[model samples]
Target: MKVRDFMIKDVLTVNQNAPLSEVLQLFVAKRINGAPVVDADGKLTGMVSDGDILRYINPTRQTVYDMFSYVFVSPPEELAEALAYKVETPAKKIMKKNVQSVSPEQDLEEALGILAKHHFKKLPVVNEKKEVVGVISRGDLLKQIAGRLNELNAKTVSR
Candidate 1:
């Protein structure tokens, strides 16, 4: 099967100019961990995930390296205070600009390779115009495999 065969056609997408809060709300409402960011013409531009938002809003603590060991220190309260403004910031400011995508016609094995190699949970499927046509997730692939297995078992039992 190809990516287009099992990909989710009703994909959730976000606009580049959408606010971070709006993106978070969408994630909660749709119960998705990530979404592809699209342009006004519905062209895929970037991707934003819950992990990305978390990294931005709650930055990791600073690590100070000593001669013998590393000392981890918490971020200054001021830094946390500063990040509060990010909620209203545009999604483009925090979205991952280097997005990896696959064509709808691409083979499922090819998509699987990319996902496994990159440790990605989902991949955006694009058309020739570079517009997002659908999205395929690890769950989708698993479901397809399960269905095929069931079919094979049924066929064997009928023989």
Candidate 2:
């Protein structure tokens, strides 16, 4: 099977200039873990995921010293809190640009290989012109497999 057979054509995308808060809300409202970020011409630019949002909301420790300092020092804690709050300022600032994309004509195994290698939940499906037309997720692949199994079972019962 090909990616086009299972990919979702009606993909939900967000503009690069969209506010981070709005983007976060979209994720929640759509019940999606991530979305492809497109340009004004609807060209794929980057991707933003729930992991990115979590990283922004949750401050990371720079080092053991920084962790200790923050724990012992009140100012560092305040600074960390302030920075986490600032993370909701914009989408362009937090979106990952080095995205891995797939074409609709690609085989399902190829798409699975890419997703496995990169540990991605979904891949943006781009056309020959490099414009994103859809997205394929792991769940989509599983659904396809289940459908095939059901068909096989029905055929066996009929025989």
Candidate 3:
């Protein structure tokens, strides 16, 4: 099987200029962990994930000396304040640019290799023009494997 055979043709994408809050809302509404960032022409530029959004909420590091010298250490509330400040920022600021992509015609083994090597959950399938046509996830491959296994079991039962 090839990537095109199992990939989702309709992908939910976000524009670079979209506000981070909108992006977060979309993720919640769609129940998706990430989205492909696309340009005005609908070309894949980057991707943003829930992990990237959560990074904004991490407390800024301070030197150990500063931690001891300060009258009060930064509290968890400070992290929330910092994240609130970034909620309206554009997607361009947080999207991952060095994305790993696959061609639609590529074999499933190549897709599996890419996913395994990078620990990626999904890969964007592109065309000759590098335009994203679909996306394939690890779950899709697993489902295909399960179907084949069931078929083999049926054949064995018949024999």
- Highest-TM-score candidate: 1
Q: Which has the better TM-score: candidate 1, or candidate 3?
A: 1
* Candidate 3 positional error at 73, Å: 8.3
Q: Which portions of model 2 miss their true places by more than 4 Å?
A: 60-88
Q: Compose the digit string of candidate 1's lDDT tens values, residues 25-108.
A: 999988999989999989999989899898888744555656557666665445557467778888888889988899988898
Q: Which whole-number lDDT from 0 to 100 does residue 80 have in model 3?
A: 68
**Every model's TM-score:** 0.85, 0.83, 0.85
Q: Considering only N, C-alpha and C atoms within 3 Å, which residue pairs clash in candidate 2? A: none
Candidate 3 least-lDDT 10 residues = 59-68
Number of the top-ranking candidate, with lDDT as the measure: 1
Per-residue lDDT tens digits for candidate 3, residues 1-159, read 888887889888889899998998999999998878888887888888889888855666653345556765543456667777887889988889889999888998899999899988878887887677888788878898899999999999999
lDDT winner between candidates 2 and 3: 2
Question: What C-alpha lDDT values do all the predictions have?
Answer: 0.88, 0.84, 0.84
Where does the lowest 10-residue lDDT sum fall in candidate 2? Answer: 71-80
